[model samples]
Target: MSKEQQIHGLRPIIEAIENGEEISKIYFLKEGNGVLFNELKHKAKQANIATSYVPEEKLYKLTKENHQGAVAKLSPVKFADLEIILETTDMTANPIFLLLDGITDVGNYGAIIRTAECTGVTAIVVSEKGSAPINATTVKTSAGAVFNIPICKVNHLKDAIYLMQAYDIALVGANEKASESVFESELNKPIGIIMGSEDRGINPSTLKILDQQIKLPLKGTIGSLNVSVACGAILFEAIRQRMF
Candidate 1:
């Protein structure tokens, strides 16, 4: 972890949280506890920041200086609010949104953002709890594209979907079992594309809410494509349709 990435000590961590810093997670000595530690932990929980207990050796490895038995990892970019993005969206144009469901890989997340930016996507929505942390690695992997696009973090993806639906944006998902091909799907409409994690495709419950599900036809022996690659393919299709 980089020095710029971590905030050490209880008082400093508390102040950072109070200052509205984007803290990804907090780590504290497993055995350490006191009024200050409890306060820090309480503050982190209230802020919805993940917290973990680590050994002294781990803290030492993270920083040689005094950490006061607590350290917090900061997100490189502040997360955007979904409601705010929707409120400011230009309803006149056919908006294109990308919704990531449980995608935890930072590299894939970064690459998806890069593609979304290139394709002129309106915004990328992700669940605040399950989404990957936008750290230095994600920023670097995106080739700095992470900074160019608006990424809305929502409490639940379903809520974002419902909001977009209310705005007349169709929900489209990329699924292997879908009978329809992505190329055949109507991409010119105001739509939101849903991409799932590597382990599981879209959650079964989420699939129920999709207005349409699309599949990318494959001729080779390979069964599936990486989530990032799949995202690029679908986004470019939308771009092509919108351009013509």
Candidate 2:
């Protein structure tokens, strides 16, 4: 088992799955009854992962800490190698990649992941830190889309961006200073869109190498959209342009 394999509150288990951790099976208090518990049962069935309802004593035996009346033995998920993810996807032709720069909000993270699955994106690349760890809530919010998509985590965001460009992907950053708008940008070729954080935009270091920059048309006083919403807008545009 990996060192990340651990026991924590019930909510933490959900986070593990959201970050693409493999779960061998989930265990619940055999006698507990409630709506939230029921929903958990149903979701496990939908995802096709194993589940077990055991006595509270078993959960206690496994861990003395607060198990929150449940414990899940998680198995790690198989992640794609960085090089394999670069070459195996649609790199030769017009490929589409999404780089999440410092996206830490769990809800936003889940929404973006859900969008990635819907748009037929090549892969979702995120950094090991400053990102929401795949967990249970993310699974719930994503409506199981995280299970279908390929999520790649790297040590550094800049290195991942460097490698993607080597694969010939048109790396673009969504910053306010960009001269072009999303509509004017050419996304018909292999592309990678880097989205900034909600509170703070993309890291300055990575911004130095941006192949191009584009901003969304803002007609309102707010002048900004959530990171997840921005990701959907950009990615679906790629899908739409490629279709027609």
Candidate 3:
């Protein structure tokens, strides 16, 4: 983590939130508590910032200064508004949007962004909470491609999914148990591809709302591929379908 991308001390974090800064996540000492701490928690919750209670050692590891039981990781890039992107983008071009659900691994998130940019995805959307921080590691791993694409952080994945559907975009999900293969699915359309976390496939409730579900065929014993690899495969298939 870069020192420039961090804000230590409880008061500073509260002020940052109040100032409408793009905070990726905040961490606090699990055993620490005070009126100020409570206030900070309230502000973070109100702003929908992700928070975690960790050991005092964790706070020290984040900064050498007196962190005062709090530390915040700042997002390197400002996120785009999903509704604005939906309204302004040329939807008639058969745009492809990628929605990430519970992807916490920075490397996987970065790789997915890189793949999305390369495969001509219109934009990428992620939940404000439970998603990976767009820190230095993520930017580096994306090979600087993060700057080329618009990334939207939404309060809830379901709301964004619903908004996309309202705009006439079809929703599809990548699931191991899905009966249809990506190659056989129709991808040359305005579609949103939902990719789940590394551990869980798509959320059951989310899967229930998608227009279709597709999977990549697996011949070996390995049941599934990494989320980033699976994303590339499906997105490339979409590209191939549109081109051919």
Kindly provide the TM-score of model 2 when superposed on the true structure, using C-alpha atoms: 0.71
* Model 1 lDDT tens row, 1-244: 7998899999999999999998988889999999999999999988888778999999999899899999899988777887788788887788899999998999998899999998999889988687788888889889998888888777789999999999888999999999999999898988999999988989999999989999999999999999999999999999889889
Q: Is candidate 1 or candidate 3 better by lDDT?
A: 3
- Give stretches of model 2 more than 4 Å off: 1-5, 8-63, 66-77
Top candidate when judged by TM-score against the true structure: 3
TM-score of each: 0.94, 0.71, 0.97
Query: What RMSD, rounded to one decimal, does every model reach?
Result: 1.5, 10.5, 1.0
lDDT of each: 0.90, 0.76, 0.93
Give the 10-residue window scoring lowest on summed lDDT in candidate 1: 77-86
Candidate 3 or 1, higher TM-score? 3
Show how many residue pairs clash in every candidate, following the order shown.
0, 13, 0
Which portions of model 1 show Cα errors greater than 4 Å?
none
Best to worst by TM-score, what's the order? 3, 1, 2
Output the number of the lDDT-best candidate: 3
Candidate closer to the true structure by TM-score (higher is better), 2 or 3:
3
Which pairs in model 1 have colliding backbones?
none
| Model 3 regions lying over 4 Å from their true place | none
Residue 82 local lDDT, model 2: 70
